[model samples]
Target: MKIYVVGIGAGSADGMTFEARNVLEKADVIVGYTVYAELVKKLFPEKEYFVSAMKQEAERCRKAVEMAADGRNVAVVCSGDAGVYGMASLVYEIAASYENVEVSVVAGVSAMLSGGALVGAPLGHDFAVISLSDLLTPWEKIEKRLECASAADFAICLYNPSSKKRHDYLMRACDIMLKHKNADTVCAVAKNIGRDGEEYAIMSLAELRNYSADMFTTVFIGNSMTKNIGGKMVTPRGYKNV
Candidate 1:
């Protein structure tokens, strides 16, 4: 009756936490988005699996809960930190309706954290995580958040930057940010972090509008004081400068 919700850490098998991997090895059934399921196929080659595409999130979590309700150990996998825009919340929603189902969450490295590590400590201070996907949230709300994050000078990490259906949102977001930040503000687009086709580039807020971003990309925009040194992007914590 235990359901382990494991954050698979940006779809990198190597990024899987030791505890998450142990749970995966013992799980009788695994459930996740189709792309995430495929990314971890090697770990659960012999286990029962359920994969769902976009917008079928509720159904996928229900299936996992059903299996767990039947006394099977299930692992619900999610890319990045499960709690941050991952399956953890959806799983909790379904778990609320059930009784006697033990649910545990295992943390993994999220793309935002990985991307921050790749650059410098842009996140050493306060930061905000935002998703540009308007499919679930209103565009006005997303825009408002972007404006607030920029105004606060909080380092921003963006997930689900762009897709075939929603291509111009990131550009639009940058345009809004420019009002609060300078043109020289450092930014990074970390694509497919820790996975194949992984690519990342550092640029300025002004240049962000020119890039072709995709769903796999995690964008990091520096604060007002962030700077680039020797090709590495860094947001100093004042200790170094003091």
Candidate 2:
């Protein structure tokens, strides 16, 4: 029995990788978060689905593993690359306790990459990805990471920027970044990437501090070397000087 932990990409079938689609097609069961499951449901409605609400990650993975151990091929889906804050690790951890269950991870485009393309190439140079959700990680640790990334002038990609309960979290992060970056630093936000009503905006760090975002938004803050090129956010890789 084998389980495929697949990355469905940024909430659209067009964004899914060929390998990921094939895995899902061959799997006997599909398990994922409620929102992710819904997205895949439209693509592969014939497959059996096991959907769970948020914060039930452990239960979801356990169910996938149990089904796989019963000699059924299973696919556990996650938005974005499975290795990045997805179900791949959890599935592996749980599958370790079960015998005869193989695990295969299929990668896909993450929000940072998809969002970056929509707003130009702000991540051409070295960058950092940070999640603003403090559910599993402490706020202090996130603050330190933001500070370090800012001081190093790394282009930053933020995920899970805000939700109803944490509306001010993105603003707080912007404030921390302001201390290390200039007020005019180029920033961008991509909403509903690769899906309907997709929209993006480029602005300054000062303007971004007051910007509103939701769980579906991805934020990008450029480094000191970033600039606006033809109204697009861009960070040079310095290949021109070579």
Candidate 3:
């Protein structure tokens, strides 16, 4: 039994890579969060589907494994890069718990990458990806990582920025970043990147503090070198000297 954990990249069919599309086309069943399941359903109208709510990681992986054990070619769908804050780890964990269930991860463009592209090359150099969600991790730990990343001057791509229950975390994170970075530091928030309702707003760090953000938003905090040009955000790769 084999399962392909494929990242669909922000739930846009156009965002799916060629390899990922091929894997999905060959899959006997598709398993994923409800949103992702709906996105891919039209493509595989005849294929069987297994869906779980958004945050049901353990149950989702267990279901995938169970289906695979029944000799189904299941494709566990994820938004953004499966390996980047997606279902890849959960699938691997469940596979490791059992034996003989073959699992493969098909990478997709992460929110960091897709959102960065929407706002020019904000991640032209070294960067760190962080999630603001404290459900599984402590807020103290999340804050520590943000502080460390800031001190290191690394470009930061933030995931799970704001949610219904966790409303003020994004603003708090912006305050922390402002303490370490200048007010003029470039910052951008991309909402629903590569999907419907897609939009991006580029601004300075100070401005970002008051910017409207939601759980669908991916925030990019630039390094000292980042800049905004012609309404597009960019972090120069430093090839000019060469």
lDDT, candidate 2, 139-235, per-residue tens = 9999999999999999999999999999999999999999999999999999999888899999999999999999999999999989999989999
Alpha-carbon deviation at 241 in model 2, angstroms: 3.6
Model 3, TM vs. native: 0.96
Candidate 1: regions farther than 4 A off: 239-242
Output the worst ten-in-a-row residue range by lDDT, candidate 3: 233-242
Pairs clashing within candidate 3: none
Clashing residue pairs, candidate 1?
10-80
Score residue 48 of candidate 1 by CA lDDT: 82
Q: TM-score: which is higher, 1 or 2?
A: 2
lDDT score, residue 201, model 3?
88
Please report, in order, the local distance difference test score of every candidate based on alpha carbons: 0.86, 0.94, 0.87
- Estimate, for each residue in 1-242, the C-alpha lDDT of model 3 and write its tens digit: 78899998877778889999999999988999898899899677888898988878889889898888888888999988889888888888888866779889999999898898898889998888999999999999999899999888888999998888988898899888777889889999898787789999889998988876888899999998888888777877764632
Q: What 10-residue stretch in candidate 1 is worst by lDDT?
A: 233-242
How many steric clashes between backbone atoms does each model show? 1, 0, 0
Task: Please provide TM-scores, in order, for all candidate models, with all chains considered together.
Answer: 0.96, 0.97, 0.96
Per-residue lDDT of model 1, residues 1-242, tens digit only: 78888899876777888898898899888899898898878776888888999789889999999889999999999888888888888888898888978789999898889878776666766788999999889999999999999998988889888999989988999999899989889998888788888777889988987788988888889887787877667877753574
